[model samples]
Target: MQYRFDVQGMTCGHCERAVRQALVQVDPNAQVQIDRAQGRVDVTSDAPQDTLARAIAEEGYQVAAAA
Candidate 1:
């Protein structure tokens, strides 16, 4: 499955990396693409959207909503 979301509080490359790492921790094989300027993240994984969102939140980002 694939998931897309708009995230807030990502200001730089480090933030992008943090989000990607947080998602990967939930599903190591998942593909995560983040665009910090756009506050977007696209993830391909079997994990549910909520699970992924929680992971991102744990990393100190706010997931505004799924897109």
Candidate 2:
């Protein structure tokens, strides 16, 4: 399924990379796009939404909600 999340605390390239990596860890083949300026993360993955969210949270970013 495809998911769009509004994320917080992403300030730089590293932050974007971290979120992307976290999602990849869960779905491996998942597609992740982070727009730091907009505080949004768009994901296309088969993994459960909660699992994906936890991965991002583990990376120390706050996921406000799924869009």
Candidate 3:
């Protein structure tokens, strides 16, 4: 499934990598694309949305479902 989230607090490359790593840990095969300037993250994974959101949240970002 594909999920879109508004994730705040990503200011650099390291922040992007941390969010990607967090998502990958939840679903090893997950694909993550992030746009820090827009606070956006697009993910393609079989994992549930809530689980993915939690992973991002654990990485210290504020996560919300995107339209």
Residue 20 displacement (Å), model 2? 0.6
Could you give me the TM-score of model 3 versus the true structure? 0.97
Instruction: Quote each prediction's TM-score.
Output: 0.93, 0.93, 0.97
Best by TM-score: 3
Give the whole-model CA lDDT for all candidates, comma-separated.
0.90, 0.89, 0.97
Q: Give the TM-score of candidate 2.
A: 0.93
lDDT of 2 by residue, 1-67 (tens): 8898988999999899889988998999999888899999989999999899889999998896664
Pick out the ten consecutive residues of candidate 1 with the lowest summed lDDT: 58-67
lDDT of 3 at 41: 99
Candidate 1 is scored at a TM of 0.93
Question: lDDT, candidate 3, residue 13?
Answer: 98
Per residue, candidate 1 scores C-alpha lDDT tens digits across 1-67 of: 9889999999988999899999899999999988888899999999988999999999998895664
Error of 3 at 33 (Å): 0.6
Better of 1 and 2 by TM-score: 2
